[model samples]
Target: MFRFDWKMTLFVLLLLPVLIRLGYWQLEREAEKRDLQQLYEERQSSAPLPISGVDWSDKDIGWSRIQAEGYYETEYNFLLDNRIQSGQVGYEVLTPFRTDYGVLLINRGWIAAGPRREILPSIETPEDKAVIEATIYIPDGELMMFGEETLSGEQWPKRIQQVHLARMSEALGEKLIPARLRLSAGSAGELSIDWQTVNMQPEVHRGYAIQWFLMAAALVVLFVFFSFRRKEKPNE
Candidate 1:
């Protein structure tokens, strides 16, 4: 015998769509992650290309290995906060490089945070022009902004929460390149550079998708079991 519960049915209907949508969204994300991984692998295997005359609008430029000759703009530097390395909290140093092509931001590397928040670690910048090899890194999306604190002051060695290329370019009065150069291994830089190829592996997204679908399936089974089970008759 079937007993229909309107409220329960309505709840199930509402939740089912949401669960299905989430699973599908995860699948879409998995596909995107796979495509990104493939592109990254292809770029990594290719030879290092010169930065000069490269089309900035090209979508694939983000992962490309590049070489450039430029002088560091030591005075105006940026400290990207909340970077972790070797189980220690620190900041990633970013300094501008004035190259013949254009101004490019170079992520020098990570430095440990000071003992107190008021104090900052010392960063040395090379003044001379030199050949630099690095990987192009374009930020995936907009970063969460803490507040105006990161944007305050016109001081050298400015500490920022995230790298806002447009804002920084305007502040510096120069059209900086769209992407940042992650200092390649064995490059001449003060700090350490440890970059990951991808932020999240596709397998993780696929796992999440499976979990969501399983949850949806379980919900349907539970709903059916609860609706069909007959209540025990009370003994007179």
Candidate 2:
């Protein structure tokens, strides 16, 4: 059912460098994220709280202070250029909600395209108070032409699929939530939640790491097979 040939080998070798480069990038990105997560966890442990375990005054809640810190944000073209699945586009829309314990950052949903140059997307924030939970992330800031910040009172129901938490915080104007929450869509209008942060999962990153390595391996095997092929003797 499967066939292997020298042409395949040559092709693989030719592509090996590209595959390796991509794998390296993924590894690097994942490593950077790991470091950030570790640092966040550490800060959470040593950081002082405001007498009470949680600070409800801020619009959002964060383990540490709700200050600007760097994180990863995916580029728009990177998503399309890579031919990612449909529905993956501009920004990962995040909203905040109050809770008994504290605030949580809920990833309300994804916007398909960039928000209009002069407009902001209509995000139905949860009016009912509840604590929000989410990890702080920074955007990659690639392939984007960020426009001047949009002022409040300009309500446009367009989709703004871009993330710039710092800028967003300004737009929001309330104390601004510290962390983010990834919401689950279900039967009712309830904000779905996962107590554990998604980035904490080793399996997801490991699986991706394995994929990049496998592609590199495949290329090498192909190159070797083609290199060893023997030529036929000339006919007398």
The candidate that achieves the highest TM-score relative to the unseen native structure: 1
Candidates' TM-scores? Answer: 0.91, 0.42
lDDT of every model, 2 decimals: 0.84, 0.45
Tens digit of lDDT per residue, candidate 2, span 70-123?
221211111111112253434444543434333334454444443454433333
- Name the runs in model 2 displaced over 4 angstroms: 1-14, 47-63, 66-160, 163-202, 232-236
Q: Least lDDT summed over 10 consecutive residues: which range in candidate 1?
A: 143-152
Model 1, runs deviating above 4 Å: 141-143, 146-152, 234-236
- Per-residue lDDT of 134-174 in model 1, one digit per residue for the tens? 88875654457765544446777777888888878876878
Candidate 1 clashing pairs? none
Error of 1 at 213 (Å): 1.2
RMSD (Cα, Å) of model 2: 10.7
